[model samples]
Target chain A: MKKLVLRLRDLPPSAWIFFAWLVTLSVLPFLIILAMSFAVRSESGLISWTFTLANYERAFHLVYLKVLAKTIFLSLGATITCLLVGFPVAYYLARATPEKRQMGLMLLFIPFWTNFILRIYGIVSIFGNHGLLNQTIMRLGLTDSPIEILYTRFGIYLGLVYNYLPFLVVPIFSALEKFDLSLREAAMDLGANRWQTFTRVLLPNVREGIAIGSLFVFIPMMGEYVIPDILGGAKEVFLGRVMVEQFFTMQDWPFGSALASVLSMGLMIAVWVRMRFEQRKAGPTSHGLR
Target chain B: MGDQRILKVLLNGMLAIILIGGAGFWFARKSNDSAQPVLRICAWSNYLPQNVLTQFQKQTGIRVELSFVSSNEELFAKLKAGATGFDLIQPSDYMSRQMIRLGMLRELDHGQLKNLGNLMEDVRSPAWDPGLKYTVPFSWGTTGLVINTAKVPLSPGEIPGWGMLFESPDPKRTSLLDDMREVFSAMLIWKGSTPNERNHQKLEETLAGLRNIRENILMFTSEPRQYLARSELNISHAYSMDALQAAEMKPEFKYFIPREGAVRWADNFAIPTSAKHVAEAYRFLDFILDAKVASELALKGHFSTQNQPAWDLLPEAEKNNPVLYPDQATKARLYYLEDLGDLLVLMNRMWAELKI
Candidate 1:
């Protein structure tokens, strides 16, 4: 035990410091939120600490359950959309000549320089009733009336894809950069077709990236408010909007907090399952390395 | 090894202190007074004239802070996050009642408000807060249609009514406010059920009428001023203030309270129960109620004044604007929103259903 203490004492200062701070700052909030999940709200819209399972039970009601299910479904659709659209672009950027790769990556990042709300607002200017898109279509004699594209489910879907595609692209691009060309070449050299090489060699190699990107888009999409709020008009009602109405219009904090806690638990379970899967996959290779 | 270990231990201890101390200080500083008491006033972005705030700061020692929220929902979130330390808040009539029911508002002493008498007699002792118990009436406006005479010219003496919004051949040619209550109330009025009616059949009829309007609406927006100014819309079911704002920007724009009547709303100022500087909040409220300040607010925000004396202070050109002061008959037809209680849940759900 003395030797163990001495050895630990011999370790670098920065590493110890980083670990301590990470635990206190990053980990503490989640614990607080978890603890808060058990609490209840008073008539004053303020939360009170009383250990009760009522909030969780209330969260399971049909209205909220349906909302949660819809949120998950929407997130799944967004994730799949990002993957289908992002993977090829990521691949193209990764395999491009060195000079072109920088430009492609810059194009992905340029949108980030603007305020997010402004970008969403910019969509209105382009798609509003007398907006340029409709004006152009009219000038070209495509139709007599302006196309109704501003306040529909399709508009919301388009906005989500436009906003989150970068998140998916950046990660997969990073993964593809470190991808070993020889693995794909070896598969091809051994009579494997392009599709076989991609599935067997490329997919496994970039699994971490895909997982990271999915988590990035999926988690936020579940709690997404602004995109749907602006583009969806009244057509697409999501969980976030429902939560806002509950808290503000209905003045039901207990119910809103309950809904929030359930959503948090759902997200935590999703992350834990993903991490467990990744850990299981890593175990055999880590043992081989040892 | 022993000497190296001691050195490393010393370094580790120092590191731990730095990490823990930094976080502790960060949180401490966050809680600590930044020497500026942030007074978060949740109102429309263009509602409060900055000049008035600056004048208030000069008169008093307190630094005024402001946050603009497009909807009451956003404002509600800030109020719920108690750590935000907002001293004052502005909410609409029904929202004020909801907040008061939830005990979010501080019980105001009318004695502190010197300009309380400056408010119109009718606006005082409102049903929501009888005898000015919790909130001070800030700015009032009626929800109605703003017509662009250039696109859909009114006949020689014709004014645009609510029916004009639905009667156009192209259903996707008009605009409406995105607010559920306003949109729903307008539909209720059009259906001939009183906006305050609690009957189930009335609600269903209103809901059905709204569904049709929803189909007809090109897009619903909170900021109708933008749509009107750009001519993005021919006619919009808009707040009187927003219509006045559009008229100021473009003279061709004309605003009218529809023949079916419209919902009148008053955005009010109140100190929250958690206000640290209640005196300053009261002073601020009273300052806005002053005749000069009221007129200045009218000029800036383009909302009508409830302070009757402020109307005389304005120039004849400004006073003559019908949107600023609709005639007696128009005023009689309008209704202000009152608390709906549990029925709000049904209304909200119906709105969601319509959107879907």
Candidate 2:
């Protein structure tokens, strides 16, 4: 036993620390949730230990399917908007002088200093009927009545895109900064047009950065309730809202777990596909030396 | 090299101890708060007046701490998830019933509550708690309508019933509650059905009615006070406290219980089974039960007091406000929401469908 202790002490502390985190933070909790998804909810709305497939059965209803489809559509719309807006911002930021880059980066991160919910609430006041925007519009005589922007799907899209634009920008910016300037010249020297150079060479190189950044925003977006709840005026039922209602309003823990498990499984499959794509891109050369 | 490594390890060990000791000292300062008992109560936001809490602390020499919840379901979620630190919790009528049925509440010791006689006789035995066994009624309110008369083009006397909600000149300027039970109760009352509706056929009709109004409603929000203040919402389905307080502040916005009637909910104080400071909890309860404190609470919160003595202490102008203390005819229209038992699943399912 003493030798075992001494051997354990001899091993690197970081390795054991990471192992501890893996078990406590990720693996154990996931296993528990997976087990709970199959559990039964008593008539009292509390969980019982008995196993049942009723939660999954209920989760597969048309209502949940509609919610899932809406959530995916909203998230996809936000991600696409982020990409369109982020590319130009990232290019300017990456190509700027040191001081300008620093200032630009500072501007990008300033919104993050405040609480996420507080920032969303700030959006509410700006777009609300009695808000600054509407007041300005009326003064300018843009229209007779206030344009109804608040509590609409358009407002939710603006919020999701606004919050996540920086996340997508930073990564693509880093990739652009590392890009070789002469590559464009080389492509031009080989008679490639500007559009071809951008599409063929630049985009392919930055696609990884884009994928990683999109996933960073997309995963969290799938679980977002506050932005839609506040900015969307608690209308347009999303998956996260349904999941929360299951636990709090409905008091159905088993059903909530079942919904969560399905979402997590979908996310894991996405991550697995990403990893496989990267592995195929890397090919077998890296392992040949071993 | 070995000697150097040992010296480094010793230095790090001392640093770790100092860091941990600092954290311990910081926490110990909070735990070492004198010999005075600490009473913790979790209640709805703005329910417990600061002055009352201060007076109780001064009289009993017990320190008080407070946490707040926005809804009864939130309170239930917290306690049911193994939150045991609170000595007392405030639950609404239906939630109190649900908790009592589940044996999650501690029975009241009538001997400790000396000021119990201050409560109205009618509230002495509610349907949820027979013989005042588990809960003490705090305040009663009605889910009613608040209309901005300046924009709505209607006099306070001319305000129609629930029909005005759907049939308003600009229904787009209105909002309904995000709460399933409240919205459903409003619809049930409008359709001349019981609030805690169980018949699936009637509920189906109610669901269809909600879907029709779903387009008319600008949004679904439990808290519409901010919107009403900004005149963003001309007509809103609001709680009595929010509407009454807004009416008092802005006379242009009139609040009234619709003739179609509405859901009447009461907040109550009940000790959880996991209470640690039971004696201190009783002392705090008796303090609030005092007629003087109860009247102050009602006056400040804009909710109707359950204490009869408190009602007597109120000003004549307030005592006669039909909105606050409704006339017998209006009172006859109010319905109390109860635990719907197994039918809650159906209620939630229908609510989800309506949202979709």
Candidate 3:
């Protein structure tokens, strides 16, 4: 025990300090949330000291399960949409001259610098029933009636895609920027066509970047309450909204914590799956290269 | 080395400075702790004017510290989090009742509040707090509909009651309050049932009705005034104060309590059981209850005051504004929300189902 203490003290101060801070800030709060999830709520909505699995039992009910499924579906849709729309933009920016590339990246990040809620409100105004789209259409004699765009599934998709497109673009762009040009040349030299060479060479190289970008987009979208609340008109319930209602409106902290715990577990499983897939794909390729 | 000696000297100087500063801070805090009475108030933002607070501080040497909460649930949560140093808190009628039941509030000494009689008779002994034992009514308002006259040109007679919301020619332009109780109550009132109806069959009927109208609703939001102002939403279920504010921005807008009736709410001032400066809290409550001060606060907040003398002092235009002071028939129609206790779970479930 004395030797262990002395050895721990001998370690670099910065390393131990950072480890302590991480444990305190992140791990401690998570542990507390886990503990709270097992507790019971009193008649007046206060958390009781007694432990129970009733909160978790209630969380897995059919209604809540449906909400969770919808949340996952929405997030997946957003992630795929972002990847599709972001790839071409990222490709163009990556292939641009350094000066042009910097400008393109700046333009991409400019929208993000603005307040998120303000940007959402701006979207609301643009897609609203008597919004700019309908007004423009009317002025151009295209249609007499205003086009209904806001407060629909389409509106939510637009908001999610617009908000998360940059997350996908930035990571994929960086990956493309680091790509070895010789690999593409070699694929072509081996009698591969443009499409074939691109598929065989370019796609695999950027798989990690795509995975990282998809995770960045998907995780936050799964817990998104604001965009759906503002843009989708609170017509549907999502996991984030359900959790918020439980915590704030219902004042049921244990149930909210249980919902949050399940969500975190789902997220962990998703991350693990992705990591395993990446490892399996990388293993054979790395060995072949060596 | 000379550099090593300089570094040691610098470290000693820094240590001395920190120790001295820490001592000074501790001494200052200790001195201030006993110097003056500090009254901590937790309430909704803009509920009390800064000038009124300043006046109270000047008159009584008590320093006032204010914290704001957007909702009553937040107030309850703050107290439940080990009774934060809140000498006074503002809770709506139903919430006050819940807090009282939970033994979270301190019963008021009516003798300490000299101006208690200034309150209107109706609110003097409200159902939530009979005999004004736990709370004093601060501000009151009704939850109703705000219509953009430009888009919704129909006369009041043409579109009467909550039915107008569901049966509108352009239902796509209508919005409902995002609040669960308010939305459910609106639907109930439209069905010619009491807003607080608890029958399972009736609730199911209400849920079906909401689902039917779901496609027609433009959105559910608390702050639909912006949408209403922009003509994005033609009609919305909103609070009378918010509706009036929206109408002030656009003269064409109108606020009307549907013929069927609506939720009449009153926010109240109460002292928590954990309050330390009960005397200061009483003084502050009494100061705000003064007829002139009450009138000023009412005008600034743009909500009705239960102070009868304050009502008498209002301008004829404000006094005659039907939206601010509804006629007797409308008043008869208005209902107060009761604390449903365990039954709230039912309401929450129905609310979730409605949104889903």
Candidate 4:
């Protein structure tokens, strides 16, 4: 027993503890869920020990595939929109004086201080029927009536972009701030047009920040639950809600576990591939600000 | 060097033992918390008022711990997941039947409930739990349409049915209950069947109807009060508890049971097999069964009480409210959503397909 204790002590004690914690709390639970994904759902809504590939097979059905496609489509659409909407704001922030930049950032972060649901309520007030948007449109005589927005696909897309806009902006702003502005000036001095300078020098300089920011938004929007349910009026089904529905409403833990694992597996692969691409982009000498 | 190594080993061994012993002691204390009998209850939110809890504690000296689940399905899933230490749980009619079948509920000692005689005749020997063997009815309600009259034009004398809600002028302004049973019950009854629909032919027909209606409805949600408050929804499928609350808040909102009828359910109090404080749970049950207490709770909590004496104590205006206390003819038309057991699996599949 003393020898065994001595052998155990030979390993760094803190390292052993951390390893144990990670395995118990993270790895073990994930493995259990993976196992459950392979199991069957019983009639009583409990996990049946029978092994089956039926859950995975059912996931591949056309109906479920449509859900998957919609999930990806919405997330990608939101990400792209965020980049377009956020880049200009980030540039302005980066170019602003230090005092103004601080205030701009403060305003951007104010919404975050409030609860997420409350911010969603604020969004609803602005977009609902007879909401501020409609009231203004009516006052201005823009149209005959209120425009339907919240219960449409466009609404979910806008919600995703709206919630993640700040995260996307901060990273791009940082990159632009750290960017040596002389690069832009040098390109223009060499007979480059404004668009040429922007596309060639400025954009390339901030590629790392832009990529990181896009990822920050993309990953969360992929699994977003509340924003769509609240602002989008839950007119559509998404992966996160589907998983929750299976677990809580349907009481089908095995199927919910299967759905979750599929999502997690896809996310892991996507993130891994992105990391690999970034590594190659950054090989040898690091490009862009340190 | 060898002696120093032995000393180091001894020091480490002693430390490990002390840590293990301390952890064990902490767990021991957690399990046996206090001298005061503690009863843990898992019920729907707002069903157990703070004042009721305080009053029960004051009268019986039993400490109460409360938790909430949004739906009966969620409550079932929690118990199935081996969540223990719940002395009492509030499950609706169908859910109580399911729990009884699964042997998850403990048989109630009616003798301990001195106020059992005070319960309404309708619930005393409910179809779900005959003779009140495994459950005691707490609050009962019906599922129906709650309309915002300012948006949807209708006279108080001219009653609207499910057909009107389905064929609503503005489909985008209508909301259905997100619950499978609630949604399917309304759909089934509207399609000329009972709420506890069983015929596969009819079930398939209902499924198709649900799919068609899914696209036209604004959204499906268990909670539609927020939308009604914002005037975002014209028609919503609602429980009496929520509809009444919404009506009270906004005079424009009115609860209406369709002419084709709707589902009725009773949320009941039942002890789980995991209960540790059985005696305390019984005490709390009897306190809730008390006529005056039940009456006060029914009024304050916005739920229709199943205790006749307690309900009798309510003001005539409240008693006469059509939505709360419908006429005997309307009561006869109401159907209970039953525990379909294996058929629930099929219902879940149908819901999944419809949502997709």
The lDDT for every candidate, in the order shown, is 0.77, 0.85, 0.85, 0.84
Q: Which DockQ-derived CAPRI band holds candidate 1?
A: acceptable
**Which scores higher on DockQ, 3 or 4?**
3
- Residue B305: error of model 2 in Å? 1.9
List the RMSD of every prediction in angstroms.
5.4, 3.8, 3.9, 5.0
Tens digit per residue, CA lDDT, model 3, B182-283: 888998988888878978899889989998999888889988888887777888889887888788778888888888899999999999999988999999
- lDDT at A150 for candidate 1? 74
Q: How does residue B190 of candidate 2 score in lDDT?
A: 85
lDDT of 4 by residue, B58-108 (tens): 988887899998888889988877899799999888788878988999998
> TM per model?
0.80, 0.92, 0.90, 0.86
Off by over 4 Å in 1: A1-74, A126-148, A248-250, A271-290, B1-44, B53-80, B83-89, B95-115, B159-161, B164-169, B271-286, B315-323, B327-329
Tell me which residue pairs clash in candidate 4: none
Q: Residue-wise lDDT of candidate 2 within B38-73, one digit each (tens)? A: 988999887787878888888988888899987777
What is the lDDT, from 0 to 100, of the residue B266 in candidate 2?
Answer: 91
Superior by TM-score: candidate 1 or candidate 3: 3
CAPRI verdict (incorrect, acceptable, medium, high) for model 2? acceptable
